[model samples]
Target: MPYNTSYVPNYIKRQARMVLLLLVLFTGCTEVIELDIQEVEDGLVIYGRISNSNSANEVIISRTRGPETAPTPISGATVRVIDNNGLVRIFLEKEPGVYTMQPSDSPGDFGNSYRLEADVSGRIYRTDFQELMPIIAQDELRYEIGVERDITSSGANIENDVVRIFGDSKLPSDLPEDFFIRWEIEEVYSTLTAFLPVFWFPGAGGRGQCYIQNKLGADQIYLLDGRNIRRSDLNNRPIITRKIDNSFQNKHYFNLIQSSISEENHDYWEKVRTLTITNGSIFDPIVGKLQGNIKSSDPEEEVFGFFEVIGIDTTRLLMTNNDIPVFFVDPCLFLGDKVFPLLTVPFGCVQCLLDEKLIEPGCLSCSAITNSTSRPSYF
Candidate 1:
């Protein structure tokens, strides 16, 4: 599941200015608002999600750590999910504030309703019950190579060719009349290093090739409200876009995780998406509140974050360099270039140096790359 780490922490901080900074990035005019330091209190944030897939279920608790900072994870909290029949399944604490449920534990079953409950220092916090809806499987997932304008960090606009993934789904003709949809995109691809070192180096041994996984199109939100979507089928919904970078050089797989969520949860994410994305227009709203379903026992106590129950269905699309028309030259192509003909070894392939930073020389070892793993079975 996709979680908004930055927005959650800032919302818990309760700084009006930061709140505005989130939902509304800019306005026609700016005003300075002062907050009383002594009155500022750290608020609780509980972000939890349970889905049909056990591996995707987890909960995290934390507290605001003041301004310009990340939230601090709270430890030793009791967390669990309770079904309508009063069956309680406990989540074991895997890390500080991270709690997880095993496969043997209670699974989120469709047609059954559930709610989250947490006990922190004798205080109880819970969310309203939500039913696990039927799964909405993706009917077709396809991609196309196209050109679009992109902005550089230097604020320069340039036209660039890229790949865009699109998805289509049709609801079943029977039963449930309404449904809300959310999509999470994950990218997995294989990468080869220039040098396969003899000695074991983290993610590498003798193999120079490795697999990497990361979120795709995380900056954009993909959601559909059943009420707004009049038809039974959703078509050509733009899912994600990617630049013709090194990630596309090999077998690239995009996992489209479809989640059937509650209208309230969809509203929660919609509110967050609006708060986080901006065009810097003068008509933007100055401020908005980011609230979740979780509530504290004491009405006066403040809490932030959400507890979501959803049904998930996943589908993947594979694309390789051959799929794209534009040929992208590798940044590390110098390993094969004859510019340094006399050099017996690929310069800096053995060890990354100051000059090698420009070409991502660390990738020569594969192990040096973040999230690098052994060749995946599918790859």
Candidate 2:
């Protein structure tokens, strides 16, 4: 045996082969888990154009890509553009989901970063950076709200509370007169899976009939005491405010509880509502009344409302980092040496994007402007 160590026995060799075969059979199998991406875009397609002074520049955002549709037609979307600083530079709603805007000043420039955001079904999405030489500023807008009449289903009459947008800017007389305008109202209830879409009256002459869609007929819209627009009409001159000393105080449902744990200083985030109503486009048949138990009125339970462009939040991403930087959607400002990536942080609850990573938004340094005085001195 010592002289023929290399010459192993056939029986020993057979055992070695069997051991190797057994190991391969037991440990050499594996499988991969793949991700399932749902095809989206069945919702309304709201896309639009933004006209700027700096030549023509297109706004594209992947996050804002609407859900999946059968035969998706890209046309007719109401497009809105956010400037380098996170401001709603351009916002116009088309028939479906198309928004269009002209350069309030000039076309977007290169090197400047801009973010594109959209609101659909009460959920909002923002796009990645569209680097341009410079992002132009769309004429700023001043928004207000008004109150009008809201008829009921079974015959209960109620007043309607409406949002009025009074922007001070130059109106183009060349562009065809206000032919028609359509807007989409997105409503989401905690108990429902589908968001309620309320498409309302066609407006002309920069005004028309529009109301909250999908109301339970009985829900009456409320008009806050003093909300009206400037007009020459006798009855509609100043939006008439009908006071309701009854249980349904429109201000009752305005107190929205906000957690101070993480927040930003934005005028829009301020809990109080400071909107004035316009005369021409007053609320006629508004839906959904401010309904709540007035017993021991708590500001937390009041049903708050929307005012205008408060801020832009980015889509949540699953990445190595947790704190996503917040950036102003200003297209004019380019990345300086001190600036990090043009940031947009996501809001609301989000599951892990991709896999094995987490992305969430951080508190911003800007302060939210509160309209405490705007709400009537009455509680």
lDDT of each: 0.64, 0.23
With candidate 1 superimposed using the best TM-score fit, by how many Å does residue 315's alpha carbon deviate from the native? Answer: 2.1
List model 2 lDDT by residue over 1-379, tens digit each: 0000000000000010100000110122222222222222222222122222322223221111222212222333334566677555664432222233444634443345555555443344444444332111112223234566767898888875443322121223333211111111111111101111112111101211111111111111111110121221112112112222211211122111111110111211122111111111111110112111111123342221111211111111011111112222322122353122222212221221112122111111011111111221112
- How far is 21's C-alpha from truth in model 1 (Å)? 14
Name the runs in model 1 displaced over 4 angstroms. Answer: 1-41, 149-159, 196-204, 273-289, 326-378
| Backbone clashes, each candidate | 1, 82
TM-score, candidate number 1? 0.74
Model 1 accuracy (lDDT, Cα): 0.64
Give, for candidate 1, the lowest lDDT window spanning 10 residues.
20-29
Q: How well does candidate 2 match the true structure in TM-score terms?
A: 0.20
Q: What are the TM-scores, per candidate, against the unseen true structure?
A: 0.74, 0.20
